[model samples]
Target: GAGVSQTPSNKVTEKGKYVELRCDPISGHTALYWYRQSLGQGPEFLIYFQGTGAADDSGLPNDRFFAVRPEGSVSTLKIQRTERGDSAVYLCASSPGTGVRSGANVLTFGAGSRLTVL
Candidate 1:
Protein backbone atom coordinates (compact mmCIF):
# COMPACT_ATOMS: atom_id res chain seq x y z
CA GLY A 1 0.00 0.00 0.00
CA ALA A 2 1.14 3.58 -0.60
CA GLY A 3 0.13 4.54 2.90
CA VAL A 4 -1.28 2.98 6.03
CA SER A 5 -4.77 1.65 5.45
CA GLN A 6 -7.34 0.54 7.99
CA THR A 7 -10.52 -1.42 7.45
CA PRO A 8 -14.03 -0.74 8.67
CA SER A 9 -13.61 2.99 9.31
CA ASN A 10 -16.52 2.62 11.71
CA LYS A 11 -17.96 -0.29 13.63
CA VAL A 12 -20.86 -0.67 16.02
CA THR A 13 -21.40 -3.68 18.23
CA GLU A 14 -23.19 -4.81 21.34
CA LYS A 15 -21.23 -5.10 24.53
CA GLY A 16 -19.58 -8.51 24.90
CA LYS A 17 -19.32 -9.07 21.18
CA TYR A 18 -16.03 -9.73 19.42
CA VAL A 19 -14.52 -7.52 16.75
CA GLU A 20 -11.55 -7.53 14.46
CA LEU A 21 -9.83 -4.51 12.95
CA ARG A 22 -7.34 -4.72 10.14
CA CYS A 23 -4.39 -2.61 9.00
CA ASP A 24 -2.30 -2.59 5.85
CA PRO A 25 0.95 -0.76 6.21
CA ILE A 26 3.09 0.92 3.63
CA SER A 27 5.15 -1.32 1.37
CA GLY A 28 8.50 -2.44 2.69
CA HIS A 29 7.94 -1.02 6.15
CA THR A 30 9.07 -3.28 8.95
CA ALA A 31 7.59 -1.77 12.06
CA LEU A 32 3.90 -1.70 12.90
CA TYR A 33 1.99 -0.40 15.90
CA TRP A 34 -1.55 -0.38 17.23
CA TYR A 35 -3.00 2.37 19.35
CA ARG A 36 -6.28 3.33 20.90
CA GLN A 37 -7.74 6.79 21.29
CA SER A 38 -10.73 7.87 23.26
CA LEU A 39 -12.65 11.03 22.55
CA GLY A 40 -10.61 14.13 23.43
CA GLN A 41 -7.50 12.16 24.26
CA GLY A 42 -4.22 11.45 22.55
CA PRO A 43 -3.56 8.04 21.08
CA GLU A 44 -2.39 5.42 23.53
CA PHE A 45 0.04 2.80 22.38
CA LEU A 46 -1.26 -0.74 22.63
CA ILE A 47 1.27 -2.86 20.78
CA TYR A 48 4.28 -2.61 18.51
CA PHE A 49 5.69 -5.23 16.18
CA GLN A 50 9.12 -5.54 14.62
CA GLY A 51 8.66 -7.96 11.80
CA THR A 52 6.58 -10.92 12.91
CA GLY A 53 7.37 -10.57 16.61
CA ALA A 54 5.71 -8.21 19.01
CA ALA A 55 8.43 -5.98 20.45
CA ASP A 56 6.04 -4.22 22.79
CA ASP A 57 2.64 -5.32 23.99
CA SER A 58 2.75 -3.65 27.36
CA GLY A 59 -0.08 -1.23 26.79
CA LEU A 60 -2.81 -3.65 25.92
CA PRO A 61 -5.52 -3.20 28.54
CA ASN A 62 -6.06 -6.95 29.02
CA ASP A 63 -6.04 -10.40 27.48
CA ARG A 64 -9.25 -9.58 25.66
CA PHE A 65 -7.27 -7.44 23.25
CA PHE A 66 -4.74 -8.99 20.89
CA ALA A 67 -2.96 -8.16 17.66
CA VAL A 68 -0.73 -9.83 15.12
CA ARG A 69 1.52 -8.82 12.27
CA PRO A 70 2.15 -12.00 10.37
CA GLU A 71 4.15 -10.71 7.41
CA GLY A 72 5.32 -7.46 8.91
CA SER A 73 3.12 -5.56 6.52
CA VAL A 74 -0.48 -6.24 7.39
CA SER A 75 -1.80 -6.54 10.92
CA THR A 76 -4.99 -7.44 12.70
CA LEU A 77 -6.34 -6.43 16.06
CA LYS A 78 -8.81 -8.74 17.73
CA ILE A 79 -10.96 -7.87 20.67
CA GLN A 80 -12.92 -10.51 22.56
CA ARG A 81 -15.90 -9.89 24.79
CA THR A 82 -15.74 -6.21 24.06
CA GLU A 83 -17.10 -3.84 26.68
CA ARG A 84 -18.73 -0.45 26.49
CA GLY A 85 -15.54 1.08 27.76
CA ASP A 86 -13.75 -0.34 24.76
CA SER A 87 -15.48 1.96 22.38
CA ALA A 88 -12.85 4.17 20.75
CA VAL A 89 -10.67 4.67 17.69
CA TYR A 90 -8.17 1.99 16.79
CA LEU A 91 -5.17 3.44 14.98
CA CYS A 92 -2.41 1.69 13.09
CA ALA A 93 1.00 3.08 12.26
CA SER A 94 4.04 1.81 10.42
CA SER A 95 7.67 2.71 10.18
CA PRO A 96 10.59 1.67 8.06
CA GLY A 97 12.24 0.03 11.02
CA THR A 98 12.09 -0.31 14.78
CA GLY A 99 15.13 1.80 15.57
CA VAL A 100 13.75 4.39 17.93
CA ARG A 101 16.50 6.82 17.07
CA SER A 102 15.92 6.55 13.37
CA GLY A 103 13.57 9.09 11.90
CA ALA A 104 12.00 6.24 9.99
CA ASN A 105 10.40 5.06 13.19
CA VAL A 106 8.63 8.32 13.73
CA LEU A 107 5.33 6.72 12.64
CA THR A 108 2.80 7.32 9.90
CA PHE A 109 -0.75 6.74 11.08
CA GLY A 110 -3.85 5.47 9.41
CA ALA A 111 -7.12 7.31 9.64
CA GLY A 112 -8.17 4.74 12.26
CA SER A 113 -11.13 2.48 12.84
CA ARG A 114 -13.83 3.78 15.11
CA LEU A 115 -15.44 1.09 17.26
CA THR A 116 -18.67 1.76 19.05
CA VAL A 117 -20.07 -0.48 21.76
CA LEU A 118 -23.79 -0.32 22.28
Candidate 2:
Protein backbone atom coordinates (compact mmCIF):
# COMPACT_ATOMS: atom_id res chain seq x y z
CA GLY A 1 0.00 0.00 0.00
CA ALA A 2 2.95 2.27 -0.41
CA GLY A 3 2.20 5.44 -2.35
CA VAL A 4 4.32 6.78 -5.15
CA SER A 5 7.62 8.30 -4.04
CA GLN A 6 10.42 10.35 -5.57
CA THR A 7 13.97 10.85 -4.39
CA PRO A 8 15.86 14.02 -3.53
CA SER A 9 12.70 16.08 -3.12
CA ASN A 10 14.90 18.83 -4.49
CA LYS A 11 17.80 18.70 -6.92
CA VAL A 12 20.29 21.35 -7.98
CA THR A 13 22.58 20.95 -10.96
CA GLU A 14 24.46 22.88 -13.61
CA LYS A 15 22.85 23.74 -16.93
CA GLY A 16 24.62 21.00 -18.83
CA LYS A 17 24.62 18.20 -16.34
CA TYR A 18 22.55 15.03 -16.27
CA VAL A 19 20.15 13.87 -13.58
CA GLU A 20 18.08 10.85 -12.83
CA LEU A 21 14.82 11.09 -10.89
CA ARG A 22 13.30 7.96 -9.49
CA CYS A 23 9.73 6.94 -8.75
CA ASP A 24 8.24 4.06 -6.84
CA PRO A 25 4.61 3.33 -7.56
CA ILE A 26 2.12 1.72 -5.25
CA SER A 27 1.90 -2.01 -4.99
CA GLY A 28 -0.35 -3.70 -7.53
CA HIS A 29 -0.50 -0.67 -9.80
CA THR A 30 -0.32 -1.59 -13.47
CA ALA A 31 -0.16 1.92 -14.91
CA LEU A 32 2.42 4.59 -14.19
CA TYR A 33 2.76 8.15 -15.46
CA TRP A 34 5.23 11.01 -15.29
CA TYR A 35 4.42 14.68 -15.42
CA ARG A 36 6.25 17.99 -15.13
CA GLN A 37 4.81 21.14 -13.59
CA SER A 38 6.10 24.64 -13.84
CA LEU A 39 5.23 27.38 -11.41
CA GLY A 40 1.58 28.40 -11.50
CA GLN A 41 0.82 25.87 -14.24
CA GLY A 42 -0.78 22.47 -14.34
CA PRO A 43 1.24 19.31 -14.50
CA GLU A 44 2.03 18.36 -18.09
CA PHE A 45 2.12 14.75 -19.03
CA LEU A 46 5.56 13.38 -19.83
CA ILE A 47 5.16 9.68 -20.39
CA TYR A 48 3.23 6.65 -19.26
CA PHE A 49 3.93 2.97 -19.04
CA GLN A 50 1.66 0.01 -18.92
CA GLY A 51 3.16 -3.27 -17.92
CA THR A 52 6.76 -2.46 -18.85
CA GLY A 53 5.87 -0.89 -22.20
CA ALA A 54 5.57 2.81 -22.88
CA ALA A 55 1.89 3.32 -23.56
CA ASP A 56 2.32 7.02 -24.34
CA ASP A 57 5.43 9.15 -24.49
CA SER A 58 4.16 11.91 -26.74
CA GLY A 59 4.37 14.42 -23.93
CA LEU A 60 8.12 14.20 -23.61
CA PRO A 61 9.40 17.65 -24.48
CA ASN A 62 12.56 16.68 -26.33
CA ASP A 63 15.52 14.37 -26.60
CA ARG A 64 16.75 15.60 -23.27
CA PHE A 65 13.94 13.90 -21.46
CA PHE A 66 13.42 10.17 -21.25
CA ALA A 67 11.88 7.60 -18.93
CA VAL A 68 11.60 3.89 -18.38
CA ARG A 69 9.53 1.36 -16.48
CA PRO A 70 11.29 -1.90 -17.16
CA GLU A 71 9.37 -4.01 -14.67
CA GLY A 72 5.97 -2.33 -14.68
CA SER A 73 6.69 -1.06 -11.22
CA VAL A 74 9.43 1.45 -10.54
CA SER A 75 10.19 4.18 -13.10
CA THR A 76 12.89 6.71 -13.67
CA LEU A 77 13.05 10.00 -15.57
CA LYS A 78 16.40 10.92 -16.97
CA ILE A 79 17.30 14.36 -18.16
CA GLN A 80 20.27 15.13 -20.33
CA ARG A 81 21.88 18.54 -20.72
CA THR A 82 19.79 20.07 -18.02
CA GLU A 83 18.70 23.64 -18.59
CA ARG A 84 17.17 26.37 -16.45
CA GLY A 85 13.96 25.89 -18.38
CA ASP A 86 13.92 22.35 -17.10
CA SER A 87 13.54 23.45 -13.51
CA ALA A 88 10.21 22.22 -12.29
CA VAL A 89 8.44 19.63 -10.24
CA TYR A 90 8.53 16.14 -11.64
CA LEU A 91 5.57 14.14 -10.47
CA CYS A 92 4.78 10.45 -10.69
CA ALA A 93 1.49 8.65 -10.37
CA SER A 94 0.06 5.19 -10.76
CA SER A 95 -3.25 3.40 -11.00
CA PRO A 96 -4.84 0.00 -11.19
CA GLY A 97 -5.30 -0.38 -14.92
CA THR A 98 -4.48 1.07 -18.34
CA GLY A 99 -7.81 2.56 -19.33
CA VAL A 100 -7.98 6.30 -18.96
CA ARG A 101 -11.53 6.09 -17.75
CA SER A 102 -11.26 2.88 -15.92
CA GLY A 103 -10.30 4.72 -12.71
CA ALA A 104 -6.70 4.64 -13.83
CA ASN A 105 -6.71 8.29 -14.77
CA VAL A 106 -7.39 9.39 -11.24
CA LEU A 107 -3.77 9.77 -10.39
CA THR A 108 -2.41 9.83 -6.87
CA PHE A 109 0.67 12.00 -7.19
CA GLY A 110 3.90 11.88 -5.29
CA ALA A 111 5.12 15.04 -3.57
CA GLY A 112 7.34 15.49 -6.62
CA SER A 113 10.99 15.81 -7.53
CA ARG A 114 11.87 19.45 -7.80
CA LEU A 115 14.79 20.10 -10.13
CA THR A 116 16.72 23.32 -10.28
CA VAL A 117 19.18 23.96 -13.07
CA LEU A 118 21.50 26.78 -12.23
Candidate 3:
Protein backbone atom coordinates (compact mmCIF):
# COMPACT_ATOMS: atom_id res chain seq x y z
CA GLY A 1 0.00 0.00 0.00
CA ALA A 2 1.23 3.50 -0.75
CA GLY A 3 -0.24 4.81 2.46
CA VAL A 4 -1.73 3.59 5.70
CA SER A 5 -4.75 1.38 5.06
CA GLN A 6 -7.48 0.71 7.59
CA THR A 7 -10.18 -1.91 7.43
CA PRO A 8 -13.96 -1.48 7.59
CA SER A 9 -13.99 2.21 6.80
CA ASN A 10 -17.22 2.26 8.78
CA LYS A 11 -18.27 -0.05 11.57
CA VAL A 12 -21.57 -0.04 13.40
CA THR A 13 -21.84 -2.20 16.47
CA GLU A 14 -24.00 -2.50 19.55
CA LYS A 15 -22.90 -1.73 23.04
CA GLY A 16 -20.89 -4.50 24.71
CA LYS A 17 -19.72 -5.91 21.42
CA TYR A 18 -16.07 -6.23 20.70
CA VAL A 19 -14.37 -4.52 17.78
CA GLU A 20 -11.06 -4.95 16.12
CA LEU A 21 -9.65 -2.39 13.75
CA ARG A 22 -6.75 -3.27 11.51
CA CYS A 23 -4.05 -1.00 10.18
CA ASP A 24 -1.39 -1.63 7.61
CA PRO A 25 1.31 0.96 7.56
CA ILE A 26 3.50 1.78 4.64
CA SER A 27 6.32 -0.64 4.05
CA GLY A 28 9.54 0.27 5.82
CA HIS A 29 7.94 2.52 8.39
CA THR A 30 9.08 1.51 11.85
CA ALA A 31 6.79 3.72 13.88
CA LEU A 32 3.10 2.88 14.12
CA TYR A 33 0.52 4.79 16.09
CA TRP A 34 -3.15 4.43 17.01
CA TYR A 35 -5.43 7.30 17.85
CA ARG A 36 -9.08 8.02 18.52
CA GLN A 37 -11.04 11.08 17.45
CA SER A 38 -14.32 11.90 19.09
CA LEU A 39 -17.07 14.12 17.67
CA GLY A 40 -15.19 17.40 17.63
CA GLN A 41 -11.96 16.73 19.41
CA GLY A 42 -8.65 16.22 17.74
CA PRO A 43 -7.09 12.79 17.52
CA GLU A 44 -6.06 11.34 20.85
CA PHE A 45 -3.05 9.08 20.95
CA LEU A 46 -3.84 5.56 22.03
CA ILE A 47 -0.63 3.67 21.51
CA TYR A 48 2.70 3.92 19.74
CA PHE A 49 4.82 1.04 18.54
CA GLN A 50 8.40 1.29 17.43
CA GLY A 51 9.31 -1.97 15.84
CA THR A 52 7.76 -5.08 17.43
CA GLY A 53 7.38 -3.48 20.85
CA ALA A 54 5.02 -0.84 22.08
CA ALA A 55 6.98 2.26 22.94
CA ASP A 56 4.07 3.91 24.70
CA ASP A 57 0.59 2.75 25.63
CA SER A 58 -0.22 5.02 28.53
CA GLY A 59 -2.92 6.70 26.51
CA LEU A 60 -5.01 3.56 26.36
CA PRO A 61 -8.25 4.40 28.16
CA ASN A 62 -8.51 1.05 29.92
CA ASP A 63 -7.53 -2.59 29.97
CA ARG A 64 -10.28 -3.30 27.45
CA PHE A 65 -8.35 -1.45 24.80
CA PHE A 66 -5.26 -3.07 23.36
CA ALA A 67 -3.08 -2.60 20.28
CA VAL A 68 -0.32 -4.70 18.86
CA ARG A 69 2.28 -4.65 16.11
CA PRO A 70 3.77 -8.11 16.19
CA GLU A 71 5.91 -7.62 13.09
CA GLY A 72 6.21 -3.83 13.30
CA SER A 73 4.52 -3.21 9.97
CA VAL A 74 0.92 -4.14 10.68
CA SER A 75 -1.11 -3.21 13.72
CA THR A 76 -4.50 -3.96 15.22
CA LEU A 77 -6.51 -2.21 17.86
CA LYS A 78 -9.02 -4.21 19.86
CA ILE A 79 -11.77 -2.69 21.94
CA GLN A 80 -13.86 -4.69 24.36
CA ARG A 81 -17.22 -3.87 25.92
CA THR A 82 -17.84 -1.10 23.46
CA GLU A 83 -19.97 1.72 24.80
CA ARG A 84 -21.83 4.58 23.18
CA GLY A 85 -19.08 6.81 24.35
CA ASP A 86 -16.70 4.76 22.28
CA SER A 87 -18.22 6.00 19.08
CA ALA A 88 -15.48 7.72 17.19
CA VAL A 89 -13.01 7.46 14.35
CA TYR A 90 -10.07 5.21 14.95
CA LEU A 91 -7.00 6.46 13.13
CA CYS A 92 -3.71 4.80 12.37
CA ALA A 93 -0.53 6.56 11.46
CA SER A 94 3.02 5.72 10.58
CA SER A 95 6.32 7.49 10.39
CA PRO A 96 9.96 6.76 10.02
CA GLY A 97 10.62 7.41 13.69
CA THR A 98 9.69 9.53 16.70
CA GLY A 99 11.31 12.52 14.94
CA VAL A 100 12.65 14.00 18.16
CA ARG A 101 16.18 14.35 16.87
CA SER A 102 15.94 13.02 13.37
CA GLY A 103 13.26 15.58 12.48
CA ALA A 104 11.16 12.88 10.87
CA ASN A 105 8.16 13.01 13.16
CA VAL A 106 5.89 13.59 10.22
CA LEU A 107 3.09 11.01 10.28
CA THR A 108 0.90 9.71 7.53
CA PHE A 109 -2.61 8.84 8.71
CA GLY A 110 -5.00 6.23 7.41
CA ALA A 111 -8.50 6.95 6.15
CA GLY A 112 -9.70 5.80 9.55
CA SER A 113 -12.36 3.42 10.79
CA ARG A 114 -15.45 5.14 12.02
CA LEU A 115 -17.03 3.09 14.79
CA THR A 116 -20.59 3.85 15.78
CA VAL A 117 -21.92 2.17 18.88
CA LEU A 118 -25.62 1.69 18.81
lDDT at residue 48 of model 2 (Cα atoms):
87
| lDDT of predicted model 1 | 0.93
- Compute the lDDT of residue 84 as modeled in candidate 1: 96
lDDT of 2: 0.91
**Ten contiguous residues with the weakest lDDT in model 2:** 98-107
Model 3 lDDT-worst window of ten: 97-106
1-85 per-residue lDDT for model 1 (tens digits): 8889999999999999999999999998888999999999999999999899999999999999999888777899999999999
Tens digit per residue, CA lDDT, model 2, 1-118:
5788888799999999999999999898888999999999999999988889998999999999999988878899999999999999999998887654686357778999999999
* TM-score versus the correct structure, for each prediction: 0.95, 0.94, 0.95
Off by over 4 Å in 3: none
- By TM-score, is 1 or 2 better? 1
Arrange candidates, best TM-score first. Answer: 1, 3, 2
RMSD of each: 1.2, 1.4, 1.2
